[model samples]
Target: MDRPSSPAAPAAQNPVQLYGSFHLGEFELALPIDALQEVVTFPDAIARMPLAPAHLLGMFTLRGLLIPIVHLGSFLGLPNGTDHSEARIAVIASGDMRLGVLFDRTGEILRVSTGQIVPLRHGSESLGLIESAFHLGQRILQVLSADVLSRLPGLPHVLNPDLAQQASQRRMAQGSRHQAISFQVGGRPMALPMEAIHEIVRFPVLEHSVLADSRCRGWLQLRGRPVPVVDFASFLGLESCSTEAADGSDSEDLRRVMVLRRDDSYLGLLVDEVDSIVAYLGAQLLPMPAIRGQAGLFAGCISRCDTGAHDLILVSAPALLAEPYMAELAKGHHDLYLVADDELRDVETTRQRARETWVTFHLDRLMGLRIEQLCEVIDYDPTLVRPPGAPSHVRGVLNLRQTLITVIDLRSLYSMKEAEDLAASKILIVEHGGYKYGLVVDAVQNIVNIERAEKLRVPAMVANQLDTELRQDLREIVDLPDQTTIMLLDSVPLMQRLTGNGGGSTVVAALPERVVGQA
Candidate 1:
């Protein structure tokens, strides 16, 4: 390994650092070391940004934002060596700007320059970072500038959304990010992003009341507030390291409580041990060493273990919480039970609207559309028109999206005289057919997911009772809470009719029906 020359003991002191020697292939360029930040091991990342400087080797991301990685050697007419990983990125900063310049491996930091310098005649020369030429013993070093490197040609381009997408995908696949938060679960090490953890609590002695039924640690008084603690081992479906439960002693077993904030929920994760923050470097990891029974619980492991270091397996938290035990634990718990499903979670939450809409009702003792559909429940607003010459079931016209839609009283059409309760007659504002419509219900109630299997054929026996015209559209018979099968109204044909026509406002009585198994 060839090293750069050590700094001369300066009876004369210049701390700004003059000669920052970086090897471009075999040749040396004198850069100002004081301007240089620490050299970091550059990971192999994808470059997708366009209109990049010729010096840049495509574009890459640093710290989640898009930043380009430039190939100094390629631009400087130096030999094209191996990839950037074999090289190190020498970070240089000037004033408010910073950039990482690539090198074929790292060379020594030498301080040497001519008070008055020279130039090379072999290649086409550039004026910027390769400032002026100077001489060391047996070598010529061209002085480089950190400032000029950043401001080279076409360096001020903004990020392209499409290129950002490609780079993000490439980052995940390559595991290029090195920084990670690590800990121990069941004596096995695991690591994740430090950004993921809110705070870590040490050795929380979960009361039997909390863990007995709820995976939640009985709310511990943290700053006078009850914070939910999750048993990490149990939640991950991994076996606990120790079988003994806490006995309410002031002194308890050591466990780490990791507070995690998801979109709509905040929960605690209980771990057997906690380790120091580590740099994962996107290395490959294993879940468990051996497939012992339910060994699939672990994600994967890192091949090389550095003493206290081990590759950490990242667990999918939502999948673990979805276990049958979650519902059981949530039973009787004060808080309403809801899955912290990231996939299902809406980025832009609408709680008031969501609550109002997701509600259920009954018409003739049968389930109406889901409760969540009713954006509002109020006395019939007479200001909205009542469509004329419709049917007995068509109660009136309601204004939705500046259009009049015939409001249907579902119970009357089904001929369930017992279903019509005057006090329970309320207007429901439903969103469908690319517009909003209103329904007059006999009774309104809590909304729930109608749990039903698919492709239900209303058997030949009950076929006569359903709509002879719209029979094909009834795809499934979902049994609701009241145990009566509610029909899932097919909205596609209705939407098409409403949108296809002028201002598309009305639900046509007769239209093409839904094929069975459509859902």
Candidate 2:
């Protein structure tokens, strides 16, 4: 038998290559880091595709596009494992085609020089799927070619150009759309314009008051002011949908109070439950049919579901506030709570000035950027256009409408591990110097109002560990009572650094070349 020839030594100038390794049964496999987008947990739901090959697991939605998943073990003719509950899906991209392959678990990233790789000899049976092999300690790691995997027989191709066009159409329609906070009252679905809602809180213990009645349930102390709570169903002359038993034992697990504020007055509408926030096009709203009594309270009716079978009553805040009883209640609340508490009013005035809203997201840890600095938070668009000679941290440029926005990967910039779940990632769009840029983050956590006094300077110990670029952009740290600390990033300085106006280092040398009619 002839022995295999030893691999030749690579030139001294050969750069180290990064490979993302994963396990398939007993075999260890890897792919070039650039080809891999991200790894995500196995989806709980998958839509079966008709007439697909046996190796095709099914299709699942990532972000907004449908991605076809493949069973790597089945395609490789390996025996099926008894358990796969902990399986992960590795997303790989080649040109406009994306594919997901199942793996038992993921391993560490392997940094190997060109000299360590052994080229595959002629007559190998891999059919170009396995590019080459390299030994890592006692185990041999087979490198897979992404282009070959994407073009494998019977694998469905995901055309991103079509998806991009669909996204563009959605963006064009956004101008005529409005967001509403959907909820349930009197066992019926309803919604209010999101801007009219101050906040949603749980059903707090009420204090008995002279204002207690069928319409006015009671009053609750919120912050330092008294807010009159009204039984919204009773006010609308509808049946109660409360889950409380007739015996009077409270069962208010799902009940919520939607607080509405106008100037110094506050009112709470007790509802059965708080549903989801929805965005609907203006054309979807239809005029309300003439019904008896309180029908005028609704500005219009809109379809809550895609099939248009379920309608949601769109409450008009102006009409609700204009009611005689609502006006009286507002006056009573102001006279009883605001006028008498002179000291409390002074304290609230100071507090209001110090309150600031911040949009929080996850990176290596919890972090925030001021809400005013953000244009919007959107799902990560995977169909990005890569221009020649772009920077390492610049993921790519995405054509949002007709404008090209450069995407900066925060993980790459901060030297953190690549995000594992691209489907769950978000991009914070920010404008600086009349240009829009998208900052990629792991996930968006919440929108919070933090007091200015709560923000503290970054401790010396923590600041010393951060990179000089990152440390300079660190504005303040907020520590919540629950032991969660959030590091706030100063958007101005960060944007300045990226635009090469602040600090000597430049993140992106230039904006990516715009593609005509790309979207």
Candidate 3:
């Protein structure tokens, strides 16, 4: 056999290059590393691009720049990428057009040389976009043409003046359509116009207000200013779709609050939960029904959801957020200030006018504390340290973030029956004199809003179990719609009685330096 001749040496100028690779459907593909700009996770909201072909996913903001996501699978004749958590958008910039390609997941950056790149046979189909392939042991990787891939079909084919003008006109016609957010109120589906909405937020801690209207729920001090919260169901004259059990019991789960814009002011619309944002064509909306008094609340009805499920009642933004409602809210404040000086006012009168919100918890039966006085809530820790000669009420000192938080057992403090398993119990932190104390309870429940009209004075029977100081902490008793009664406790007096010995302050000193900012 003849010996094979040695391979000829090439010029030193052409060096191997690196390519960024990622899994596309069943196959792995590579693009020039220099062409790859970034890899970003999917955004929360991607604006739908009108008139764009299926291959063009949508427009998403990447580092403040709006970039388009291209469905690489569709372009390759494979199934389009689904909304999998592992899916990522690989941004590729080509000239003036910057876009992203969807992929299953990223792969390793591989180094390859021109000599190793095996050109496919002319008859073999490696999609026109795949210029060549590289053999790596048993696997073959297809290198995509970055230039041709960036120019997605249906995008400007020719830089003609007429084509650009037509695209601009199409976008302008689609801009005026309404975008609305759908949500559940009292189990009923409803929608608020996108133009009238400011933002959707998690239920925030609302400061109890005696001056605000009951229908308004209460006032939330947002960003140093008070924003009134409206009960969407109540405003619509529907049955309360409160999250708590029908009996007006307490719950700790967060609700969805939709902040809405009314002129220059903002209002928080409390709903059961928000569903999704959907766009509607003008012709899809049915004419508003003229109900005797409800004409102002309903703008139109959306016959079906995008899935053709339930019907959606469109809330008239202009009417729901009318000047008359604001006038009524303003009148409530004026009336409250008028009677502010009367300290000896009848309880019946206050109950009939004011609304109170309580943070309920359970020791044995349902119990509550005034929401206004609550500073914060923390989870209970089982590893709390017991100090020597601690009282029955003073269970132990908890090292919460290095702050020595004195935990008070509500059951022991009130001489009530304790639960066999206190593992799920929570600590309610109340602040007084710059010190914080933890009140341990069985379970934190829901927040219930009660009409002052429904509140009753604490009965003498329940009051007899406590000494005068503790008895004074009993705020009132209110009957829930579910026929259950909740005994409301006042936090200020309770905190004072629990920490009168300066024990909370002493506990703070005993805590390690790490807990200084535990609050």
Candidate 1 deviation (Cα RMSD): 26.8
lDDT of 3 by residue, 344-446 (tens): 2344335424866677888677888866566556677888887766666667777644457677787776667766887889889776666667889888887
**Lowest lDDT block of 10, candidate 3:** 1-10
Q: State residue 321's C-alpha deviation in candidate 3, in Å.
A: 16
RMSD of each: 26.8, 21.8, 25.4
Q: Which lDDT tens digits does candidate 2 get at residues 195-258?
A: 5665566676787768778888888876566788899998888886464633457632667777
lDDT ranking, best first: 2, 3, 1
Runs of candidate 2 with Cα error greater than 4 angstroms are: 1-216, 221-227, 230-345, 510-519
Error of 1 at 32 (Å): 46
In model 3, the clashing pairs are 250-445, 250-446, 251-445, 251-446, 351-452, 351-453, 401-515, 402-515, 403-515
> What overall lDDT goes with each candidate model?
0.50, 0.73, 0.63
- Cα displacement (angstroms), candidate 2, residue 191, comes to 16
Query: What is the per-residue lDDT of model 1 for residues 365-447, given as tens digits with 9 covering 90 to 100?
Result: 44445333333455555565444445556566654333455565555544546442466477775555334445676666553
Q: Which numbered prediction scores highest in lDDT against the true structure?
A: 2
Off by over 4 Å in 1: 1-258, 261-359, 368-379, 382-384, 387-391, 399-405, 412-420, 431-434, 450-455, 467-473, 480-484, 493-519
Instruction: List the candidates ranked by TM-score, beginning with the highest.
Output: 2, 3, 1
